[model samples]
Target chain A: MNDLMTRLELSALQDRYVSIIDNDRMEEWPTLFTEDCLYQIISKENEDLGLPAPIMHCDNARMLRDRVVALRNANIFEQPVYRHCLSGLEWTGDGADGYRCQTSYVVINTSAAGESTVFQAGRYLDHVVRTPDGLRFKSKRCVYDTSRVQTLLAYPI
Target chain B: MNDLMTRLELSALQDRYVSIIDNDRMEEWPTLFTEDCLYQIISKENEDLGLPAPIMHCDNARMLRDRVVALRNANIFEQPVYRHCLSGLEWTGDGADGYRCQTSYVVINTSAAGESTVFQAGRYLDHVVRTPDGLRFKSKRCVYDTSRVQTLLAYPI
Candidate 1:
C-alpha cells in the first residue's frame, strides 16, 4: 500500500479498536491482537523501575481471553460508560510485519448516577498490521499518566 | 551518551518521577516539565473520538502547579499507600531535545487496613531531557488498560 493509504488504514484500525472497548465488547477485543502479543496496563510508579508485573499482563491471546473471563466473573466494580476521543495520530514508520502509530487520547467516564468524570487518562501505542480482512493489532500498550489510581481498573481502556 | 548510558539515565529519571509522586512531593513534580510542556492524563474511552479533554491537562508549568494545589486542598478520597513497580524499558529514539522511552508498570494500592490490591496497570510514554541539574520530564502520558476505574482519581498517576 501507498504511504497515504497505509496511514489511513492504520488510523481506521485504531478507531475500530477503540470502538470495541467503548462498546464493552470484551469478547472480541482479544481477537484484534496477534497471537504473541504483549498486552500491558502500567502505572507510572512501576514503569520507571523496569518491573514486569502488570495489573494485567498477557503474553498470548489465550491469556487475554482469560482476563476478559475474569473481569466478567471475578471482578466487581461500578460500571461506567466510556467515550474515547483520539487525536494526534502520527505514523512513526513501517516495521517488518506492521506499522507503528503513536496517538494521544482522552477517555471520559460517565456513571449511571449521572456523575461524569475523567476516570483514567493516557495514550495508545499501537503496533498494527494489514491483514487479509483488515488491519489488526500486533501489540497494544495502553500507557497511563496517573501514578496513583483511585481504585481497581475493571475494564480495558 | 551511548545507548546503555541513555537507558540507565532514562530509567533513573523515570524512577525519580515516581518517587516524587509516592512521596507526595507534588510541588516538585511540575518543575520536571519543560516550559512549553504538554501534560495529559487521558483514558482510552476518550481517545477514539479525538478529544482534548484530559482529567488534568496542563499546557504550561504553572498550570501543573495549580493542579497539584487543587488536588492537595480540594480533593477527598481514600488514603491509600501506593507502591510503584516499573520495568521493560524500551528506548524508541532520540528526539532533538530528549529521548523517547516507553516502559511498563503496575501499581499496588495498600489500604489503611493493610489490604493491598492492584490499583492500576499501564505504561508510561515519556519524553526525557537533560536539564542543568538532572534529567527531567518533557511530557509524560499514562494510559491504563482498564477504563472502569473504581472510585475517584484525585491525584496524579
Candidate 2:
C-alpha cells in the first residue's frame, strides 16, 4: 500500500468508484471497500430526528455485497441511472493505514425514459487506503443534506 | 490572535457564532468575519449550474455590516426565526492565517404565528482564522442541499 498518493490519484480513485455504479457493475462495488468497513447513506431529516438508520446501511464489505446482490437480483424499480459529479477533495488527515479526505458531490438520476433530475447533493467523508487492488475505501460515509429525496434511493449513494 | 486553536476551540467558536444569530444580535454578526471576507448562501441547484449569484452574497465585513443593518432596520418579513443544529465538524487543513473546516447544519424556522418547519439543511464550508477579536471567518460558503427554499432567505444561513 503506497502511503504517498497524490491528490490526482485520489481524485481518479473516486472517479473510478463512481464509474462502477454508473456502468452498472454493482457487484464489484463491495470490492471497493476493506473487508471490515462501513457504507451508509444518511438523510438530514432522519439525522435531525436522532434516528441512526440509513437508507443503505452496510456495516461491512459482506453486507455491501449483499446489497449489491439485492440491487442486481431482487429490488424492483424503474431503470434509473446515477451520474456523480465530485469536487472539493480536500485532505483532512492520515488514518492508521490510509488517508481521510472529504469531497462534495452531486448525484443526478436519469430515468429509463430519459428524464434527468438532480437526485441528491452531499459530501463524502472517506477513509481510503491503498490496497493490492488500488485505493480502497476503509470507510465511506455519504452525508446527504437533501431534506427530501424525490424517490426511494435504490442505488448506493 | 492565537494560531494554535485546538479542535474543540474551533468547534466552540462556530457554536458561539451561531448562537449570536439565534439570539437576535444581528449587529454583532459582522464581527465574525475578517475585514475582507466572502459570505454566500448557495443552493444545490445554483451550484450545479455553476452560477455565480448567491441568495445572499456579502463580499466583505462591510457588506456583512450593511446586511445586519438592513436586517435590523429595513428588511420586512413575518417574524421567522432560525434554529441551527450543526454536526460533522471536520478539519480539512490549516489556512494561511488559521484553519479550514467543514460542518453539516440543519436550520429549522419558527414563524411568529407559532408555526415551525425545517427551513433548510446544508453544510458550511468555512475558512476561519484567529483575529484580535477572536475567531473570524475569512470565507463562509453555506451549501444548502434542500430541493427548494420554502420562503425568502432573509437571514444569514
lDDT string for model 2 (A50-82, tens) is 799788788889888887777778777764556
Shift of residue B149 alpha carbon in model 2, Å: 2.3
TM-score computed on alpha carbons, candidate 2: 0.57
TM, every model: 0.49, 0.57
Q: How much is the lDDT of residue B129 in candidate 1?
A: 77
B56-123, model 2: which lDDT tens digit per residue? 88888999988888777776776568877655455646655678877666666788878775566666
What fraction of the native alpha-carbon contacts across the interface, defined at 8 angstroms, is recovered by model 2? Answer: 0.00
Candidate 1, which segments miss by more than 4 Å at Cα?
A1-157
**lDDT tens per residue, model 1, A14-92:** 6556656665777888888888887888765566677766676677898889988988897677765564656678776
- Looking at candidate 1 chain B, the ten consecutive residues that score lowest on lDDT are B86-95
Error of 2 at A15 (Å): 24
Error of 1 at B47 (Å): 3.2
